[model samples]
Target: MKKLMLALAVASLSSAAIAQETYTVTDVPVKEKSVETNSFWSNWFISAGVNYNAFYSSQEEGISKNPFNDRGKFGFNVAVGKWFTPGLGIRAKFDGVKGVQVNGGVWSPDNIDFDYWNLHSDVLFNLSNMIFGYNENRVWNFIPYLGAGVIRNCSQNNYMMGANVGILNTFRLNKRLSVNFELSALAAPKSFDGIGYKASGNKIWRGADKVFTASVGLTVNLGKTTGFRKAVDVDALMALNASQLDALNSALAAQQNENARLKEELAKKPKEVIKTDYRKEYVGAPRSIFFNIGSSQIASRKEIVNLQVLADAVKADSNIKLKVTGYADSATGSAAFNQKLSEKRANRVADELVKLGVSRDNLVVEGLGGVATLKPNSYNRRVIVDVVK
Candidate 1:
């Protein structure tokens, strides 16, 4: 019955570790670069491993006994674990020992036999960065964890509960798989059942048992998190935006002025009107289009295709510039939802334009939610393309 309960607990833990919630790709771009100093909450993982244990017994008189005549007795353990964050996690383990041998008798010397099983629950702390230099690139690949747990050991005639400490190392193969190795020390409570030996004229039994264990196995992650990349510091990114754009524009203007001056100097020296049939007449206008989607920015295929056509037209016209205005139909939903939906539509159009070879700097994008659009009109669902030359 105890063994059955232990097995159920381990199975439940394993299931929970494997079960994960998935996010949509449209919601978050998967290719976004991760920031170096992001919090650990974003990277969570789960694992399982096969383990081997060494059991050592002791007498009530404070005399410890080595179960092996000349070697330590061996056992087995299996565990399921999950990391709530990058460096912290919890694990549940099922452990058992068989063929345990102990010293017995002084008159007719022979070894006594004992066997037991244990169920444990523990919380793990990561220490890979402390021991080894683990920065962003390497941190995801190699990690070391230390943990402490309560152990419940059950035998044929005895049941003991105690505590244990352990250490483990994991090598991540990818986002969905990893290799794990673990080592632990289990301290079992005192037992008074006598072995087949007499000590100080009293029947001798093993006292507290200390067990050392090691394991290695592979872990499989079930549902994957969409954007596994590092987080971007929004504050830092926003702060850098204006300065970067200004520097870029300044450099571009300087180059354009230099080119114009050189062209004039060359024309003064000697010039010819090199007319070619390949030259195409430019007569395009710059346009800004606005669209109002409802509380959700999940555009249908038809809508996306319409936007694509609009983008292509702008791209074919070198003289035309585009400005996209995104709005929410009403203030019926939560303000936050409306704001996000508006932004989503704006970003979606901007992305499509970029794909159609429109320079992002030349395209202006803005979101005006709820406060502007009073009702849901099919015309309001429309994208207004204002062409400006």
Candidate 2:
């Protein structure tokens, strides 16, 4: 029962992870990231779990009897599966069931013990991730499957071909380990149970027999440790690229026009006039370096331009120094949490400035935790840069 509860908790978390897109960088194109190509070993998994199974004979009335009365019928299953894509996969499984207790009602007044070994192949669908969108950090997943296989009934000394449909809930503990809770129903022929349904004392009916099972187990993710490729939002990235290209074109056109205007003005003036030393004043707004929530990486490439500007300013004047302060959103995190997040954000920006030729001694870096906020929670995840002279 404890295993079952743990599985449930993990499954819940996986569902929530699927719905979050926090790492997605808005207003910027996604950088090139590696993805595992489709290959023989790309998306394989292996699992072993303990199962509790109940048998249903056709002779029973009102669907099912007390499942717990025969709850002692425990089983184990081992399976290997692979995903061809994020949505679909196939698995081959072997199950050994024991002491499946059954009561003979009306047809006989005795209890029977059932046991079987089943070898099955199933096609699986990742329903949870499909609807919610795939998240690499997601911890829970829901998979539903349908399968068919041959079952060897050891107690009855017979064999039967059967089909099963079930849902597998996976709670990822980490990249390599996950807990699984699955529930499935198996349908087989009554002959496999050594029970023949009869009409008026003559054997005439052969409807489907039933076996229900619930299992909890751990799965070792094989092949790709992540078991999935990080999904790229192609549409969003393309839109960002188009916007940047358009801005570049507009800037080029404006510069050309400005040069033409300057040439016309110079042509009108005396070319022999004495030239005087002139200094162009550089004026710009302070920059905000944005980061993803819970991330300190220098993610926004656009921010590099801002850092370059500060580097130039500081280089031109040894007296000039820049202050960098980082912050985290308090709406979702604690003070201790925000403090660490803020510190990382500040240091990351400072490191980037240093790499861009600014001296570390000329920069004042501070992690203000959740103190300064420009636009509430989401916008608070940032590092601000101000030049001081």
Candidate 3:
């Protein structure tokens, strides 16, 4: 819970600091990050491609196993799909032209191919998007799917049921254009091929038919809602504001306790008795200016009024030497960065002292880097002004 609060506090402070300024990272401008979301009508696409359809059957167990010269023939496919999220989607596809097979379960090169159409609707999963986060501008994406469809041999007027599975690879060319490569397999009853060899040589035909395919095509995204936009949560920001208020109240309480301690220490000190002929020495209690965590600027210029009083005493005594030291919290920033930040803070306070009529040569400005001498991390982010004897 402490870690969460610290993160939220940093975020809240950053939000307030950059409310009017804009910054960039790498090439893209920075924006608040959130989840990807789209409406039902968004992310819809259509595609068309040519494929090589290879028919598989246990009946042709011993047929020549050369792919380019086998019963696999050229065909075409068209599909329509929609992405529901970065990881999931659905697609309906139509594939067919002609499929090839052997007559009498024997290899004779007699060209016994049949005309058919296969329609399948599959639940698609984008592996790239699911594994890595979604990037609409990403060049390539890998997707796989599974579904059931109807297969009809138009030449024989026969219809059968089929199950389908496949992997799709797409390369994005632009906002609306993509090149697609797909590999798929479908399984159906052997009779759906319209090959009436009835007995597969002598015995009765059995088992299912498999069609393996490899296709290449192009896709067109339908509309403008191609990617997700980050959303700003108003409620979380409001909570951060409340947390910031609590932090300020705590700082105020710390300051009050510090004032009471200073008063107690002063009461114990002996009073100085200077004769009328003696020169008065420039004297004052040590003063400190607080800052917000990780910042070098003074949190409040209210401390400047107190410094002005110290400056007047210094102007009266040329022998008075004052040291202005700055520090950062040990909990944040790198050692080198904190050192530099402290130096900057000390100089900032010294400049203010000079503006109030204190001689620059009498003021020694130094930075002690990071320290934890004070309670609460915020108290460590401060600059102290003390008389140097």
Candidate 4:
């Protein structure tokens, strides 16, 4: 009993360790747009991967002649999940796989090829804390799951209660489709029966069986709704009074007027004019650039300096409208915290640009706290200065 408890404890710890490591191991790609949680039901995922399993029983050991050993195997699963909330979801899956040989013993009159297959159900519990602990919001791209169900050993048609712990790394191939890579370990406390064939007569054996396997597949989601999509709309939400909205509108109008006046003034000033009619005919220089930093909002001094240079460049281009976009790295903090950091970063950069003579209207600032981005790159941390003519 103590050994069984110890094995269970170790398995739980292993599950937690792998769960913590999933986000750290994968590179989160950028999301070009906002994702709506209400639309989660629209997606279906199919995955194939290899897994390593360990069985818990003495009977399983005698039959296979190998216990607690790692076996190479392959498996595939299909799942449909729906997000009832941003961090909570429910998934139903059907998975099947065959075990690989782990022992090096020769197959003679005494030794026989050993393998097992299973079909089971899994309930997914995503570790929201792991997703919120990273510096990049792309942390959501990696989800760790724990599930319990009944396993049927196809070889002998025996049933056993089992549990699985795994990590899934998903790549959004598009809005409704994604590709998944999974690694898992399923544990069953049962032994392989019917090991000795007609030559030696049938006998029951008990032992531990370990299966290690891998697969790749795609998910397609349907029935999507955009209502649950949350974007940075604090200013809009904070406008409690009609007078405040009117004031904001007036301020926006005044800023636009000021921008127009500055453009006219610069056009008349020969010193500020660039003599490039051909350049004017082509696409205008980018007036704004956007960066998606994975879950962190802390701006380094270097980033500040880069913003300063950007502000200076915007000041030099009188016709430019600087749009500063602040992004959080994959979800590492509370939603509220990420949102605040994103807005603060954007506002900080905007305020600095304002000090450099860029009118507020020319700077459209916004924060996308949950926007995902490519991992392992600094390009996600950025400010776009579009020189809009």
Candidate 5:
């Protein structure tokens, strides 16, 4: 019994599982107009470039050489950048510039070779993608940036805080790599060049020092052909999950209901067991209909009337069933002939019950051969009909 119950439980669960379908979560591409819907770790880029820097500072007559005669210096910059949106990003950069001339006044007429290192944190904007939307195959993009950070003159052992602004032009080579051209200007305090000039017997300060820089570099994207990715909408995914759940529940309910009906049908079916004699108790009084010896037909109209009355009673209550037993006189013909006659009598009575509106299924017909007897042989050759409620 425990095993049966366990099997039933497992079957029920299996039905429920079959009713509820399973789904796998997949990456769905959704297009939106405004926001970047990409992976958080995507769109990172690093770049390395060589730069030419030109410096400008306050000069004095008769003491300052022409700085522009051999002005520009060689430098290199490296930057790591990330785009927060399709059009906006930030970069942290380092630059090392050498071979710059910091000229002195009358005290030191010669020029001193100077080198500087700069660190910058800059905000970047992609003008091309902003104006035309993003296109991977587009050959060129124009980006501009503004930054402020520290600059250290390694040769002079001095540090100064400054700001720079630049415009970058990029040409795409493939999805992951690009070539970049940049033009920028840097400005710092007057003492940034580490030179103080004396005029009229007093040391004087000048305007800010400025450097114009131009560079070319290779930019490499960190991951994927499409530099950026879009973010998935949480609400949309939640709604889909809820809808799928509702459908699963409805199917499960239907499966459960079907399983219950099958269980009921199975319970009602007859099982294989040992056959036993079941004594039937009758409802109301037992009635007898007499028949002539050797004749299976109903010869008397009185017998027919009695059969009709019994049929009506059984029909009135569907729960009532009738047992019809036919008997023959023991002193009559051979036992085999008497048994056949008895069966015919029983069947004739059952037919009458059916014609009188009683269901045939409600009448159980049987033949008892010439074995049992009553005092009157004529009465012995008769069919006995009794109601089993």
Candidate 6:
């Protein structure tokens, strides 16, 4: 039935959180996080772009100041930077050529046209990587930066200290190249713009000379790109593997003994009535499909055995409707991330059932976000199927 599905995606081992790591259901262990650091210059990059600049000053308030009327407010920008880590980086950028500015203590219909350059070093923070975990292949990244620098006004032959802030949006075209869009604003001392308190009845304005720019550019990485790689704990994984094998062997033996005991008990009783083919032939099989932490794909071929038996039963009786539920552990990821992970697990199981000859219409697939229903959280990262009615 179609209905709202709540998924409890499960895993004691974390995919994104290292140390709060997660384990898998297969014999071979998988490492889902990275903690290694890269060498210097490994993540360096350079970019170049043209931008339309806008200037504003409190002194120009009385007049309608339009950047379009100021032909000097158009220029080019360039930068070179490096990512020290997935979430942090730094860059030195230059934007300039010519710009319009209001002169100190003077108000003019035609502002000063000044040839200059603004150079600043920014500390970059990749918001996406910081919040969602590092995913190198991620196409888009949102980076905000802050910095301080100096602006040289060539016409006035003077320099002023400046500060800047901005957001940089990057769309990765490949491992080595990215298309970038940037929005930034810079602030300088009012006197640097030839405008001072003396120009306006000696009034000290609250703001300074400001320039805003919007630009699009291309960035090419200077060297090899380094990404985080999973940390391997061989001894721990081997121990885990041994314990998991023991558990599986025990469960299988117990189930076999139960089946045999039931068969003997039935033989000792009176003749039973004939049941339908689906009910009479199929033996009880585990109805849960397990997966690795932070993964939806079935990891082992053995996981499909019981699922195959269930598929046959559905084929024998097409009327049977099975409920397929998926889950992820709450300990590994954020709620929103777990919700999506859970749905993927459920859908993967449903797809497998369909492959096994079960009609899609006869299946109700839902995700239950994150839960800790099982002893070991790794077992919870799975899809569970049962008869709907």
Query: Which has the greatest TM-score?
Result: 2
lDDT of each: 0.51, 0.72, 0.76, 0.50, 0.74, 0.74
Worst 10 residues of 1 by lDDT: 20-29
lDDT of 6 by residue, 1-389 (tens): 01111000111111112211222434334344444578886889999999988877645555445555553367899999888888889999998987777533234556678788999999999999888877879999999999999899888888889999999999999877899999998888876666653235545443577788889999998864455544556777889878877866775566556555545555565354323333322323237788898898986778777787678867887877788888898767778988999999899888888888889988998998988777567877888887754
What's each prediction's TM-score? 0.48, 0.53, 0.51, 0.41, 0.47, 0.51
Which runs in model 5 stand beyond 4 Å of their true positions?
A: 1-32, 60-68, 102-109, 196-206, 224-226, 230-389
Q: Which regions of candidate 1 deviate over 4 angstroms? A: 1-50, 60-74, 99-101, 105-110, 130-154, 192-207, 226-229, 248-389
Q: How accurate locally is residue 154 in candidate 1, as Cα lDDT from 0 to 100?
A: 32
- Model 4 RMSD in angstroms: 22.8
RMSD (CA, angstroms), candidate 6? 14.4
Per-model root-mean-square deviation over C-alphas: 20.7, 16.1, 15.4, 22.8, 34.2, 14.4
Candidate 2 local lDDT, residue 344: 93
Higher-ranked by lDDT: 4 or 5: 5
Model 4, 255-309: lDDT tens digits are 5565555455555663553333433322233322334444333345444554555
Distance from true location, Cα of 78 in model 5, Å: 1.0
Candidate 5 clashes between residue pairs 3 or more apart in a chain or in different chains: 37-229, 37-230, 37-231, 38-229, 38-230, 38-231
Q: lDDT: which candidate is best?
A: 3
Deviation (Å) of 79 in candidate 1? 1.9
